[model samples]
Structures are given as structure tokens and as C-alpha cells.
Target: MRAKHNVLLVTNDHVSTLTGMADNTITVSALDRTKVKINGQEGVGRDLSLHAVATGKEYVHETSKDDLWFFFDVEVASNPALAGVAGFTTFVMILFIISYWNSAGSSTALVLVALQILCFFCINPYLIALSDWRNFMTEEAEALMHSSVGMNKALKSVLTLIVLLTISIFAFLMLKSVLPDRSIQDMGDWELWVAMLFDSASLTLPFICFGLYTSLPLQVVQILASFPFLFMIFFSTTFSPGAGLEGVKGLRFLFARFYLWCVIPGVMEGMEDCPKDNLTLYTVLSGCLGLFLFLGLQGVLYVVEMNKANAAAADFKALQGSDEFKQLQVEMKYVHTDGTPRGFGQTGVDYKDGYEATATEDSTITVSGGAEPPANEL
Candidate 1:
């Protein structure tokens, strides 16, 4: 976590800005991260080229505006532990599955295979989190950034739902296997499909809240609590037989347990090969459908939201050669607060001449410029 501290101060794909630890206590240098320093400012250039390198570390926070939107802010905030745990688990499971991947008992191979599927689903988010930068993303990038963020949220929500529905269906089959003589086919058109979707959605709340909240034991408890209800759905149907059916026969006819229990897109339907075992095909189809649905909706939303953001984004660029910025060069002795602006004031300051630093009665620092120190020529 400390690896990225004090890294940016501020940056965008086009430029990098370095500030200070207030009152000029520490002299910060960027080296422009380049051997060829421009403008004599060299180490302290106001807007350094992003690709410039210093001290062997890469200076650019991100290479393009697309990355700032497509990956940075939203994904970077996700739990870091996920990558390590997922990687190690996937690695070991993969090795084990490789040994048995082609065996008829390959159903057992589904363990790592399922995890790898989940890992792939997590890939972009993990990369985004890894790409997290400490710099301030420009307001110019905000429109596209915000759009990307919103679209990701909606996408993950839908994806989380799809996977949960698929897994819940599989879990239901496992529950049914517990009974000696139950056949999912006999359940026919259970009015319970609607309930199953909701239950599955509830189970998904943990993943939906992945970065927002994480408590493994609590999550396990929540899932364990659902098992009774899941089992009860089959148990009741087993006893009453006719209870799974209802008088209206409306959506029940439209909703098929076969869709939930079977219907793997690229594989056989109803999982005829292994009715009693978990189907790898189901897991694969679930992940695939989730990706398809997310990409489909995300494409539409990106066009719409990005168009609006792009239109508004033009005005967010830094102003060129304002006279007010010229004055700050001559007569301001200001301090920084960890390289971030303290406040933005709308009016001029009444500082006495020759004062090293002055604060008005309002307690705001009277810097030559407001919170936005006008862009300086390197």
C-alpha cells in the first residue's frame, strides 16, 4: 500500500505535476524523469512529459486517456488481496486440473476450471486495480472517466446477477441429488424459478459489495443460511408433488427448470452426462453469458455517455498564458500541504507587503493564484 505514496502529487496522461510537503520543507524533484530536462526547470517542471523516466522508475502514470477511463479509478479501488489469492489458487488448481483435465473424471477437473473462469471474469478489474495511480486525474478526463465508471458498475451488477443465477441453478441440482428418487424433470414448471432468481441475487450481494465490503466468515454465514431455503424448495416439491404447479400457469409455463438445470450453450442440454454431478459446461456458459451481456450493454452506454462527456470535456483544458499567473511568479511565498491545494478563494488577499506568508481573517492562504496555481511554463 505504501508503495505508491507521494508518487504523483498530480498527473494526467499528457502531463505530470509535482508539489511539496508544505512550506517548502522538502525539495521535491521529478527529474522530469528524463535525462533531457527542458526549460531549465529540469527536475521541477510544471508539466513533464509522462513517458520521461527518472531513477529507473517509469514516470508516466498512465499512457493514454482511454486507460484513465477504461481502467484506472474504478478498478484500482478493488481489494488487492483478490489478485494474489486468485492467482495462487488458480495456479495450483490449474496444475492439478492439468493432470486430470481430459479424464472422464474430468468433472473433478472443474474445480480449477471454475476458479479460472471466475478469475477471467475478474481479470479486467484486477488489472484496473493494479493500474491505480495516486495522481489527480484531470477534469478533462472526468467525462469519459465517469462514463466508464458508471458503465462498469452497471455491467458488474448484471454480470454478478448472471453468474449467481447460473451457480444457483447448479447448486439446486446438487441439492436435488440428496434425495433418493427426485428427478428435476418431474419438478416440471415450478413456480419457484422467480424465487430462485431472487435468492440467487441475494447470494450475490457479497460479490457486488466486493470492494465496498468484505468479510469472509460473514459471507459464508449468509450463504449457509440460504441452503435451508434452497433445500426446502426441493423438499416441499418432493412431498406435495403438485405444489410446484400453480393455477395461473402463466409465467410458470414460460420459465423452465430445464433452462436452469440444463441448456449449456456449447454443450449438451440438461447435462445428461452427469445429472448427479456439477457440470463444468454450466459454469462455462454462465461466465460466457455474463461477458456477452455486459459487453452488449456496455457498448451502447459507452457511446451515449462518452458522447456527452466528450462534448463537455473540451472546456476542461488548462488555460493558456493568463496574466494573473504572471503576478504569482514575482511576489508569493507559499507553502504546500502534502502537494495538494488547501482551498480555492474567489477574491484577492489583503496581505501586507514583504510578508513571507500571510493568512487573512478567513484563514485562507493568500497565494498568488487561487487553488489552481495557473499553469507554469516549464
Candidate 2:
């Protein structure tokens, strides 16, 4: 009677016995941090962001991937206030520069195209010697002069730039040949994607120009400098006019306003004055903004690091002037074991093993000491 009142709980399972068809699947994959060498990786990282590499540097904090488009991949120590102000100002100025080019007529673009071509062919190798920026190259190049490191870096940079320019030139031509006449503008996936590529080059150009100047390891530079575009690549999922990530309309308009201002806000501000149909608007606009930011940080890092190098040099010079080396002081001076006397200022120290040397008034160099008797010998 008590057993009949026992409670029962039921869970879903095979009662009569049923076998569910399944595939035994296993997945395995692996990834590791890629080795990268920048001009002082930590230094470059610090310049790019305000974060400290040290565990305990006070009053400095890093701003990581907070911005929509800006990022510093490495941890770098810098004054937080200075970094904030510089980054903000540079970002604003970039917008303005893009605005200027957005309205510039086809003539300006034509001139730039020609100049870039000239830079690739005629002026690329001599690039490292032509300006103050190239000064960074001097230290490293001097360190590895005539060695494989320098030669390999040089070849890599040249080849990479050639490839970039080829892609740029080809993109330029594709846009020029495909666009409609300049009355009313219509943009589609082809135009948008091409323009994005064209504009994305802006981010890479400064790294190429200055990085080559320093002959930093180009293999890493090639990979890292490509990141800006690579990051924005999600925007290129499609080439259609309506293609873009979902967002507020107001935000889109605001961005469009900025883009037009950069792409072709027409000095006056109308669709006609706007970027309209010009693709290089996309190119010059983003590129110029990227150039501004790069230049700002580059200028800062160059001056700061250079000052450090100079300060270190000065400290070394001061150390060399210390009194320890006044007369090249010796650890031990030699005198005859039999207590023979030699006049002061007459002893000459010889570097020979097992002997101390002295010069007599005859000007003949002589060894004045004998080797200790060996306890064990051949």
C-alpha cells in the first residue's frame, strides 16, 4: 500500500530502443600571434596609442578599439592628455583636407596620378635620402650596412611599393573607363567598392613612404599596414547601391555629409558640388585624412625618440669624461719581485701574458717579470 503511493518522475529517452542517426564530427584548428618587428615595436606601439608598456607607469591609460576607424595594435606608453589632443586635432584636420580634395576638379586628380607614377619609377630608391623623414633609416642602415638584412629589406620595400602602385593605377583606370557622363550621378556597388579600395590606400601610403625611409622589416609592415583596409573590409561585402551595415538614417546622412565633404562636397555644397560621381573623391578623401593622422604621430614619435637618442649620447659622453679613465688607471702595477727600484713615470705596461713590461732609457721595450713556476708541466 505504501509502495503504491510512490512518486514517479519521467525524462525523455529511448524507451523501446531507437537509434538516432549522427555523424561523428571533430574540428581542430590553431593560430598563434604573428611575430612582428616594427621600428622598436613597443616604441611604435606607444606612439600609436597612449598606453604604457610598463606594468606600473602612473597616470597613463590606453584607449583601445573605441574609435570607429582608428586603432593602435600595440601597447605604447605616452601622456594620455597629449595623445588625446593630438589624435582629436589630427582627426579633425583630416576631415578638412578630404573636404578640400572632394571639391577639387579633375585637374588635381590628374596631376596627382602623374606624380605618383613618377614617384614609383624615378624617385623610389633615392627616397630614403631625400628628406628629414629618412633620418630614421640612417641608424638601422648603418648598423647593417652591406649585410643581408639591409639588402633584403630594401628589395622587399621596393617590390611592395611597386605592387601597391600597380593596384592603385589599375583601380584608377577602372573607375575612369566605367563612369557615366557628368550630368546626374548614380553610384552602384562597382563604384563604391572601387572607391573604397582607392580610398583605403590612404592609410597605407604614409607607412610605405616613411617605413621605407627607415627600412623597417617590410614583411611585417606589409601585413600590419594593410590592417586599416582589412578592418574596413566588412563594408565591402557587396557592391550594390543599398549595401552597407544597418545603422540610423541620421548617422548615415552625417557620414554621407562627411564623405561628400571629402569625396566632393563641391566647394559650395550641393549634389553638383558634392563628390557627385568622381571615384577619386573616395581615394583622395580617405587617403588625405589617413596621411594627416600618420604625419601627426610620425612627427611626434620622430622628435621624441630623436631627443632620447641625443640625451643618451650626451650621457655617454659625460661618462667617458669621468675621472676613472684619467690615466687609464690599472688594477695592479708591476714592480720587480726582488724589490728592485724603477723610477716613477718610467714603467711601461705591456699587455703580454705572464710578464710586466718596462722601458729603460735605451728606448728598447723589455719584459721585467718571469712566469710563475708550474706545478704541473709537459
Candidate 3:
């Protein structure tokens, strides 16, 4: 007779199930040097492999969901240290200038308000870019997860929500300081709040319209700059196994299959074109590209305005007070140095001739004196 036994073994790499004859003993090794798995995928693990065979990077490692975010979304906004300083300092200085000037009854406060308004407007186009990119990334993340090769969609959604919330907070605080008392009251109304949503959209028009006014000629230049890079991303993803298996195909196909259905018709309507799918994508890309130009142009203009205001303020301060300038006079008074009555002069004549006569020598003096005494007596 024979007894039966079963064994279950689990390890980091694999699971094993074994059945043996009754009363049989088997030896199993815990750490097997002969076998290893490369990140849950079969094969493709070696210690002493040639450079040519192993030198190339894995597509999964090099081009993936997180890598896309790193390159397209996060890298530009990274270096949080610098970004933090820029955001905080600009916000603080603008707020301080607006508040301090207004409180001190300075007429320049209105200019400060105007600058703040410009800044408020300038940030909108950036917000549009950020929001569109967020939507794009969210879609890509969804595609990856749908293909069952990425992180959970819930995490991505949560992260995107957090990013949007942070942006909203920054924008709110930035614009709040510039609102007048009456504007604050109006903002408290629900109807006004509803109106604000549309108003906000129109506010972004300044950024775009200003750009159109200033740099219409640069339209082609801007599009050309983004074309090659866009081509690379479109080509790489289109040909990629991950993208193909996920059925994204290429940029146009991916848009046609996915985004076109969602955003295209509205874009076409905005462009006042027929609902044909051919022109939909061009309309969408053109709108996005136009927004990029708008941001760059308005950003440059706003900076120039601030610089002009700063220079004018400096010049005003330089000329405000100086000893070389004096008030006008209505009357004049004269003063004398030496107290002379009007203008006067004095003159003196020669010495007195009849006052004294010289005496003669000593010997002749006696006779001469006697004669002079007689003559004087006579």
C-alpha cells in the first residue's frame, strides 16, 4: 500500500505544486541560483551577457506612462525650488505693491491694479495649456490602464485632482488681492459666480487677442517649432507595441479613434466648419497651437508693461525734490552793508600852512627871536 502527499511552494518569482507517493521524502532548495524572473516576465535575465545583446534598453523601461509624464508634463515644471521662489516672490511683491500704494493714497495704485490685472490675464492662457495637458495625460494614463499594463486609474485621477486644486488655489489668491470692494460684493452672488465662469473664458481672450495683434507673423514660426517634436512623439507611440496593442495606432488614428469623438465636433463647430472628420483634428491642433502663441505673446507684453511702469516710477522719484528749483517771488527788498545814507563820499585838503613857522638856528635865534618878538608886539 502507498500513502499520498501534496506540497505547495511559493517564492518571490514563482509558485510550485508537487504530488508524490505515500511516505516519500523530497528535498527542496529555497533559493535557486539557476532560475530568475525579470520583473514577472519570462526569460531575458542573465549575468554574463554580451554588450550588444544586453546593451539596448527595454522599451517598457524607456518609453512608458511615467516616462511620458516625466518628459511631457513634469519636467518643465520640475525644479520646485526655483518654481517656488518665482511664484512666491512675484505674488508677494505684486500684492505688497498694490496694497501699500493703495493704503498710502498713492495715485500709482491704479497702475498697480492694472499690472495685477495683466498678470491675472497672463496666467489664464497658461492655465489653458496646463488644463489641456492634464486632460491629455489623463487620457494616456487611461489608455495604458485599459491595456492592463499601468497603474490604477484611481491614483492618476486623484493626482490630477490635486494638481488642479493647487492651481485653483494659487489663481484665486493671486486675483483676490486686486478685487475692489464692490467686486467682492458682486462675487458673493451666485448669479455673479455663474457669470464669472464665462467671464473667465473671455478673460483669456486678451492673452490670445493681444498675441494676434503683436505676432501674427510668428504664427508659422510657432507651428514649425512644435512640428518635429510632435512628429517624433506621434511616430514613436504609433509604432510602439504598447500603443499598437492598446489600439492607439498613431496620432491621427489615436485622435480619430478616441479624442475626435469627444472633442472634435465641438472644435469643428467652434471653427464653423462642416462636421467632417478630416478637418476636425486640424482645427483642434490649431486651437491648441494658437493658445501656446497667445501665452508667449501676452507674457512678453505684460513683462514689458511692468518694466515701463517701474522705469517711469524711478524717473518720477528722481525729479521730485531738488535745491535747484524755487518758488516764484512777487516782491524784492534791498539791504545796505555799511549804513551810509543813500550814496555819499567825503574829501580832505592840504596841511595847515598858517599854523606853524620854523625857528632859526641857535646863535641867530637870540637876535632873530628878539626881532621877531618886537615884530610880533608891533
Candidate 4:
């Protein structure tokens, strides 16, 4: 067989061309031919010919090593999607750095910033990966991938939460150490930081759970995921002077920031003189409230999906019993075994008199002499 050359070069430069050709050159030589006689004419060629060819095994060797190396080292390194996420994370970190410098050594603002970072890290991935989860469900059966769809979703969510939380904590500590006028030592006791981290995660849990379990579209889900942050910024007393106002205090539970604010003492203005007993009570209540919201939202989503499924099934059953479906079945019965209408050549039945059924673009079956099927069926 004639040999073919397939060269892989890193660039079109002369250096790359020489390097590629030197290692991947192939040589072929024609063999001597003998005279052969055809049916009507004689030809000066051998019945069978052979040629010597070089293996050029180095061509495959060079390609195997260099192609993959270039793909992963160069192509993947330059991918915009990966760069976008990293750039966004860096931008957010820059904002936090600015906040660190401007907060006037107030740990409350820093902790709030940390919680915002935690929430962003946790929910951003959910928004980005929702389409992937949907695609996976569409392409594979639930039984093959996990015990159930909910279990698979929960597993993914839990793993992502752990990873993002670890990363956020590490980033926080690193920033605290390297930034001017800030050090981990001045961030207060380790136990307080630990408790703050726990409460922050608790505050973030319900939003994460909502993103995971809700059946809403991606845009709507994202808007809902952002509601807590917006509410905290504009409606809560986190950065405002209403912390001790009677009306604001009464409605504090409605805002997630209030729970977090209560967890850290002296964070709220006018509340520094408040009793520690009340702050401790709010701390305990925050944990309980987080758990309650998390589970309650998941349960509500499950019920909503179940109700949707039941309504769809009921509609399908109603469609099955409808007169249009009966007419379709009757018309189908007159078809011959070979799929031709029995009325076409039958002696007694006239095909013209028979009902003609055509399915519309919306998939509703219609008969020539009857009203169009209802759009609400299924």
C-alpha cells in the first residue's frame, strides 16, 4: 500500500517545519514490474507489485505527545469561560480588599463582606451548572446516575458547598494576613471567627437550597437568589441606623442580615448597650431559622412538582377519554394491515365519506367534520 504523510507542527515557521519534516519523513520506492498479457492486448506491467516504505513511527510519536500537550497547555489555558469565572472572582476579591481598607477596622463590615463572598461563591456555581444538570437528566435515566434525581442534585450541591466554603475561608484568611493594617491576630478570637463562619454558612444555606430545588427558569431563579442580598442592603439594619428602632427590631426576623448581625455583638449601632442575653438568643434562633427555611423550601418545591405531575396526568387521562380521541381510534381501525385506508378499494365503504384526521402543528388531532381538539389536553 502507498504510504501517506500526516505531519503535526506547532507553527508554520521554518524552524517548526524543519523539526517536523526531519522526524516524520516517509520514503516509498516502486518495485520492478514484469510484462503481462491482457485479454486483447499486452501490457508491460506486473500482475502484482510491491514497494518498500519507511515506518515513520516518529510521526505518530511526535503527534501523540505534542498535539495533546498543546491542546491542554495552550488551548485550555486560553479558554474564555474558565478565564471569565476567575476574573469575576478576582474582581470581587478586589472589591473586598477595598472594603477591608475603608471599613475603619470594623470587623462587622468585614464579616458582612465575608458572608457576601460566601453567598456569591455558593450560588454562582448553582446558576452556572443548572443547565449542565438539566442536560444530564435529559441524556441519562435517573436510575443509572443516582438513586433519584433529588438525591443526585443534593449530592452535587453538598459537594459544591463544601468546596466553595473551604475556598472562601482560605481566601478570607489570606487577605486578612497580607493586606495593610490587617492581620488574622486582630480579627478576634478563633472561636468567634469559627462561630461567625458557622452562622454565615447557615445564613447562606437557604439560598443555596432554593437554587438547587426550585423548578423556576434560570433567570427567575437568579433573580430570586439575589433577593436576599438586595433586601439586606436596602431593607435591613446591617449598615443603617435603625437597628434599635422599635419598628425595625420587631421586623428583624424577616431579613437574613438581621440574624447574622445579631450573631456578632456590637455590630449594630445603638445595640452595643443591648443585653448579651438577647444577642445569644438571636444567635441560637438564627441557626434554627436557617435550618427551618432550608427544609421548608425544599419541601415546598417537592410538593409543587408533585402537584404539577398530578395535574399533567389528570389532563392526559381526560384527553384519553375525549370524543376526539375516540374518533381518532375509530378512524385508525379502518386502515388495512399494510397501512392503506380500508375504504380506498373496499366494495361498500366510500373513502370520501370517511372522516379525515390530521394532526395540527400543536399536536392536537382534528377531524374533518368535528371541532378542533381542546388545547388544554395534556
Candidate 5:
């Protein structure tokens, strides 16, 4: 009897399987000769002939499978959703500023522009991380299973910072073009802008970490992601200076938007009627502490998720080795090479005229041979 067995070639090293048919002559064929070995000898062409000893054992060798996660691109530049959202928000803010240009004071308008930009950067990472968590975690988890290096969080963060910096420069140019000369002068130097951009990008990391830490449903994720933006709009120092949570020094230290409001106005001392009394070294250190606290909490959450994913992967591997699964796989013969059920001509039915015959469940079907029947045959 001719029997076929499937083995997982996880590594390049030789692996031996016992056939339990003593002293039998065996012939092995590979899709490629140079890439495979049989019984300690490389194939002569596509086939390798071997004599099994009384032990009924044979060895096969193949190259290692490439780690799928290594090729996954997690850098923010590859994600159009993030860039598109940022661009749209920037455009809308610019329009708002232009519409109110005649009524609002230039300093307040400039501050408003800065706050809007800061809010975009602050809220963006959470949404993106939540939406793309599966992609991120899948690659990382698989890479861990394969004992290979996965996506590096530090590397991704650095790339994200670079993209944010680029966007910040473009935003600055647009804001400069719109603002009056006096307001531009009061906006401080390039150093201040760079510092603010760095802080904004750093602020995004905690949000990203928090998003990845949660495994909620999509609706819940969206709701949770929107909370930060809503909080900024309603409570933070984004709008009226005298109203809504600005008096709460603890909030100013905890949230990035409030922290920016407290710090940036102080740094730009030239701007009249701008709040500057809150920007102290101690306040800056407090903001940093808040960021670190979030980072630590999210780090713990990530480790928990990683452990869960690893355990799930182990269970799946065990299930793959079960005899029931193997039996089911064998009974389902009319499947494509990739193991999907053939969609067309898969019911072993015959029709008249243009209709084609289909294979039975006991038979196999190739993709090219499984053409759809005529439309009239339905």
C-alpha cells in the first residue's frame, strides 16, 4: 500500500520518521532535489532511492522555514490610515483658524493651533494601535513561537517619532503662513517647536501601549480610543483658560494636553495674556512621571497578553497533532492544496451541455481543473 505522511519541517536539520515496515525498499521524491536530502544522502535529481533497515526508519532534510514576522512592517510610515487622519485633522484646524482669523487674537489663535496639533498627535496612536493590534500581535507572537526576533517596540517608536516630526514641520510651515507676523514672532524659535514635537511624540507611546494592552471588541476599542480626545475637548485646557479642569494642577501634570498648555505658554513668554506661571521644572518632571507610570502599567499588561498568546499557540500545536484532526483532514479530499474546500465543481455533480462534472469527496481537485459550471446550471 502506498501511504503519504506529512511532517512539519520547522528546522533545516535532518529529521527521522519510523515507518514500522522492516527491510522495505523506499523511494523518496522531492519537489526540488538540491534542497532536500533522503537517508543522509542528497537526491540525485528529484528522486532518492533508499533501503530501509530492519528498524524501518528513514531521514529527510530540508531548509528551515522563513520567519513570517521578520518581513512584517510595523513602522508608522507604512500605515496610510494614521497619516490620512493626521492630514485631515490638520486641514480642518487650518480652516477653522482661517475662518476665525478676523475675530480672535493672534496669540490665542496660535495657541489654539498648537493645542489642536498636540491633540491630534496625542489621540492618533491609540486609534491606530487598537485597529492594528491583531497585525502587530500576530507577527510578534508567531516570531516568538519560531524563536526569532519580532517587531522591536523601540525601533517602531523611533520610526513613529520621525514620521511625527515630519508632519510637525509641515504643520508649522502651514501655521506660519497663516498667522500674522507678530504672532509668528511670539511662537518662539525652532528649538521650542522641536521640543514640543518630541514631547508630543513621546506622549503617543503610552496611548499605543494601552491600546495594545486591551483585547476588547472593535466597538469597545473605538469607544475607549475616543475617550482621550473627548477628555481633552471637554475638560483639558484646550479651550477657555478659566473654565474646565485647568485649576486642577493634578490633571495638568497627568495629561499631555494639559501639560502642554501649562508648559508652552510659559516657554513663549513674549505672548501676551498667555498663562506662564505653571511651567516650572517640577511640573515638567511631574509630567514625565505620569508618562512613566502609564508605560509601566502597559508593560505589565503586554506581558500578560504575551503569555496568553503563547499558551494558545501551544494548545493549537497540540490540537494539530491529534488523531481526530488527521482523520478529518484525510476524509476531506476534495480540497485545494492550501486546504480550503474547492468552491466550484466540488459536489460530484454532473450536468448537461456546458456544465462540467465535479469530483467526489474521495477525489482531489486541482485549481485549474475546478472551473465553475455554466451560469444556467446554477
Candidate 6:
């Protein structure tokens, strides 16, 4: 086994010398190995080497420790895809879930989602570590400690416990999609039914889950699909999970396993002989915070993507009307300089003169004020 070195050196000096040699002198030795060679070739030799350096000044040195957080943050921010995806998800969830807190009865699920978002912001390292762990674990096959079906059942049960959680999320998105008129005094019975139907359709997770199981061709679909819910889990664990306990209780079993195995244990460790409210509060608040953070990030991402799309459209429009494109169009026509349309080589200088004169005249006209008289004539 080769030994690894953990060397920490710091110097505030211009010159320093450290040497390790026998008797402070260089020497060499050789050994003969004819005893084990079938070819009878001797395999021992000696070489003497001298190394020297001159320094102009003296300096001091000290050993210092490196901050680990700097590297961790660097790794997190350096991955463009991860940062963008995480940030966007956080933004969108926050905006969608919490932006309308003033209206209607805020459900346990929304509160939980908001708490989860808060958690995500707080548990930055844990999120990164978990992400890395998944990537690493995917490369190797291991014993299945848990079942997917069981996890799904647990999730369904948990989600069922939370009131109007799905409806709110779906309704928020549907409203955005439909942009309802504010002047309407009230929704007609049919309109309300239609909106509810739309919300129900939007909130339907079966299709998304089924898509994950059936339609999605990508290898990472499962991972991506789990991203939103897992982030909720992460947030719940991090922030105050008080108001969101019912929501956490609603999380499917497989997703809740981590909270049961890890987050609960940590929280328990922190709170010795604590009351039930503390537990509820911790769970709900933590979850809501994480959800909020994730959605908030997602909202920002939506705006960013929208802006990018707009900018791209504007650029395309600009290119379409650009001078270069117009020039290309004119060149393609190959209209002879003469006013009369003719083949490429048929035009004379008189034709060229007329074309140039017309072009100049057209160029000089202003919309607000027509072309001025020639300076010499004025």
C-alpha cells in the first residue's frame, strides 16, 4: 500500500531551505542481482544526483487548515444544471403555493409545501449530499431495502390526509393558464364546474406517476419525477413542520421513510422530553419551509425561462428585419440596374445610375418631414 501525504505548508518568506541527506552529503550505492536472472544480466546500478537552489531573502512559515464549506458550496454552485433546476423548482413552488395565502382556507398541504421549501434553503449540504448519493448509488446494484409499491401506497395515504393540497396547486396553475377575467361578478355554475374539473385534471398525480412508469423513455425520469416530492420531504425536515404535520402525514410511505428514519431521529435528539406540539410544529414548519424554497426557486426559473424565450423571439424578429437579410433578399432578385427587369448582364451604366439615384432619393426621405432641398440649390 502506498502512503498518502497530508502536507500543509504556508510561507511568508522569500527564501527557505530544507534538506534531507546522509551526513549532509550526496552518495549512491548499487547491488548485484545475477543470482535470480536466467539471462545472467546484472540489474544493479548507482547514480548520484546533486540538487541546489539559491534564495535572495528569508521568510516565515505557518501551517493552516482549509475551510471545508468553501469547497462544498463551490461544488453545489458549479454544476449549472443542478443549480438551475433546483433554483427554478424552488422558485416556482414558492410563488404558486404561497403567493395566494390571503385567499380561501390555507390547507395543511400548502403550509407543508411552503415549510419544505424553507427547509431546502437551510439544508443545502444535505440536499447536495443526497443528490450525489443517488447518482453514486445508481451506478451500482445493491440490496433493495425498500419496495416501490409500498412507497407509493404510503405516499397515497399521506397525500389523502392533507386537505385541498392538490386542489390548490392545480387551481393555481390552471388560473395562470386560463387568466380569468377580474370583472366577472361571479362564476356561473358551469364555469365553476369546468374550473374544478380542470383543477382536478391538473392535480391528478396518477397520470404523472403512470407516465413515469410507462411513457417516459428517459432513464432519469423516475429521479426527476421524485424530485418535487423529495424536495418537499427535505424542506419539511429542515424548517418548522408545525402547521404542516397533517401534510407530512399525508406524504406517501416511501417518501416519508427518510423523515421517519433520519429527520425524526435528528429532531428527537434535539428535543429531549419535548411536548407533542413541538414535534408537530417541527415537522410541519420544516416541511413547509423546504417546499416554499423549492417552489420559490422554480418561480424564478419560470420567469428566467420566459425571459429567455422572449429574448430569443425578439432576436429572431430582429434578424428577420435586419439590413443583412434585406440585402440578401435584394441580391437574390438579381434585378438589372435598369428600371426595366432584365437578365444579369444586360444593364448599362445609365441603368446603374438610375437605380443608384432612386435608392438615394428613397434613403433621404423622412416620415415626419419630407426630404429637404439640395444644399447647393438652397
lDDT leader? 4
Q: lDDT per prediction?
A: 0.34, 0.37, 0.34, 0.47, 0.46, 0.34
Question: Residue by residue across 1-378, what tens digits does model 2's lDDT show?
Answer: 011222333345532111111011111223322322222232122211211111122232232333211211211133243244345434533443444333323443333334333323332332322233234434544453322333434544554455455544443444443333241133333443444344435544555655654445654555655555444334322112234546522222212222422332122132222344554454456555545666788799899999999997786566445443221112112223333322333323322224332222212233346354333321
Per-candidate TM equals: 0.26, 0.33, 0.23, 0.46, 0.46, 0.21
Score residue 344 of candidate 3 by CA lDDT.
13
Candidate 6 lDDT by residue in tens digits, 120-198 = 3322332233333333333331232122322333333243222224333444453333323331113222333333332
Ranking by TM-score: 5, 4, 2, 1, 3, 6
Report the number of clashing residue pairs per model.
3, 7, 1, 0, 0, 69
Model 1 spans > 4 angstroms off: 1-79, 98-102, 105-152, 155-378
Residues 216-332, model 4: lDDT tens digits: 566665676565556556555666636556764555555544554544444644433333455445544654465576688678878999999999778756765555444333333
Q: Report the alpha-carbon TM-score of model 5 versus the true structure.
A: 0.46
Q: 1-378, model 3: which lDDT tens digit per residue?
A: 011111233454321211111111122224654433332323322321111122123333223576546543442456353365347546655665565443322222233234434444434334334333334544664544322113323333344334433443443444444444444343333322222222232233333333323333334433443443354346323223234433434333322112221222222233221334433444344334434666786799899999999997675445323211111000000112232121111100111112222242111112332254434332
Better of 4 and 6 by TM-score: 4
Clashing pairs in 2: 46-76, 51-76, 189-239, 202-287, 264-274, 264-275, 266-273
lDDT of 4 at 141: 30
Question: Against the correct fold, how does model 1 do in TM-score?
Answer: 0.26
For candidate 5, write residues 1-378 as lDDT tens digits. 112122433332222212211112234545544333333344422311211111122332221344323423333536665667667766765774576454333355455555556556544643465436545554654544432222344334445555556666765665555555555455454533543554454445444544454455566655654555565566544455545443552353344444444434333343223444544343345335535766687789789999999997787567556654443333333233455643333332221123333332212222346486544433
Q: Model 1: per-residue lDDT, tens digit, 259-336?
A: 233322222232333233333334333324323444576688779999988765443233213332222222122212
Model 4 worst lDDT run, 10 consecutive residues: 47-56
Which candidate, 1 or 4, has the higher TM-score?
Answer: 4
Deviation in Å, model 2, residue 141 alpha carbon? 5.8
Off by over 4 Å in 3: 1-64, 68-73, 76-89, 96-116, 120-171, 174-183, 189-200, 203-378
Superposed model 4: Cα runs more than 4 Å off:
1-128, 135-139, 142-148, 178-188, 194-207, 243-248, 254-256, 259-269, 272-291, 297-378
